[model samples]
Target: MVKVTFIEHDGKEHEIEAQEGLTLMEVAVKNGVPGIDADCGGACACATCHVYVDEGFKEATGEASPMEESMLDFASERQDNSRLSCQISVSKKLEGMKVKIPEFQG
Candidate 1:
């Protein structure tokens, strides 16, 4: 399991263990982490799961796909580390990855 930490815009920290192969958005929504709407489920069509990957964890999480990268532009808070949590899968590689709920997601 991967322990994903979500640091909200207001500075609240929420951590949860995500099962391998599930999307980050799935873990957040299923566990009621708040801020991630995931309105389109795991589809890349919606930007409701938009989040900012903590710079320290960005390289480890790797870059977002071109499609996910493009959809992030539609999000309200587009940061250099902006990503759609739905597009990120969970694994040992991302065990302690940190993501911040964007100001717009709330």
Candidate 2:
């Protein structure tokens, strides 16, 4: 299992043991992590699952695809480290990784 941490805008944290193939959004939704709305249900159609990948884990999480980048254009408070959680597949490299949920979604 890959251990991941979701930190809400208010600083609430949800640490979860996630399956290897699941996306960060999937793991958050499954474990009831607040702020990850995931309205598109992993389809990458919306920005509701926006998150900021921790600087240390950026390479492991990788760059967002053009489609995801376009969708992220609709996300609120987007930053250089911002990412769509649904676009990030969890893996061993992501163990102990942390992502911060924005105060609001698109």
Candidate 3:
């Protein structure tokens, strides 16, 4: 399992352990992480699962694909580090991954 930390708008941190091969969005929604509302599952279509990845976990998680990039354009609070959580595949390298949920992700 891998550890995922989600930072909420009110400065709260929610941590959960996810099985390998599960996407970040899967972990969030399955565990009711609140901020990540993955409307399109892992299709990379809806941007509701948006999150800002911390710089420490960026290289391990890697950049979003062009498909994800295109979808991000529709996110509510697009930012320099904005990413669709569904695009992130869980791996040992991402054990301590931390992501910040935008205040207005609906």
Candidate 4:
């Protein structure tokens, strides 16, 4: 299992043990992490699962695809590190990954 930390805009942290091959959004939804609505159910159709990938884990998480980039444009408070969590697949390399949820989703 990979350990991923989901931090809220207000600084609340939720650490979860996520299974490999599942998306980060799935981990958040399964673990009941607040702020990750995942409205499209990991379909990458909505930006409700927007998150800021921690700089330290950026390499592991990689860049978002063109489709995901287009979707992120709909997210509120988008940032350089902003990503649609549904597009991030969990893996052993992401064991210590950290992502911050936005204050609001649009």
lDDT of candidates 1 onward, in order: 0.85, 0.94, 0.87, 0.92
Model 1 per-residue lDDT tens digits across residues 1-106: 7788988889999989889999889989898987898888879987999988878878877778888877777899688888899888888988788889977752
Q: What lDDT is reached at residue 56 by model 4?
A: 85
lDDT of 2 at 53: 95
Q: How does each model score on TM-score? A: 0.91, 0.98, 0.93, 0.96
Summarize candidate 3's per-residue lDDT along 1-106 as a digit string, tens digits. Answer: 8888888888898888989999888899888887787877778878889999888888888888999899988988788888888998989998888899998764
Off by over 4 Å in 3: none
Q: Which stretches of candidate 1 lie over 4 Å from their true place?
A: none
Residue range 1-106, candidate 4, lDDT tens digits: 9898999999999999999999999899988999999889988899999999998888888888999999999999999999999999999999888899999986
Name the lDDT value of residue 17 in candidate 2. Answer: 92
The local lDDT score (0 to 100) that residue 23 gets in candidate 2 is: 93
Candidate 3 clashes between residue pairs 3 or more apart in a chain or in different chains: none
Best by TM-score: 2
Which structure among the candidates has the greatest lDDT?
A: 2
Whole-structure CA lDDT of model 2: 0.94
Error of 1 at 93 (Å): 1.2
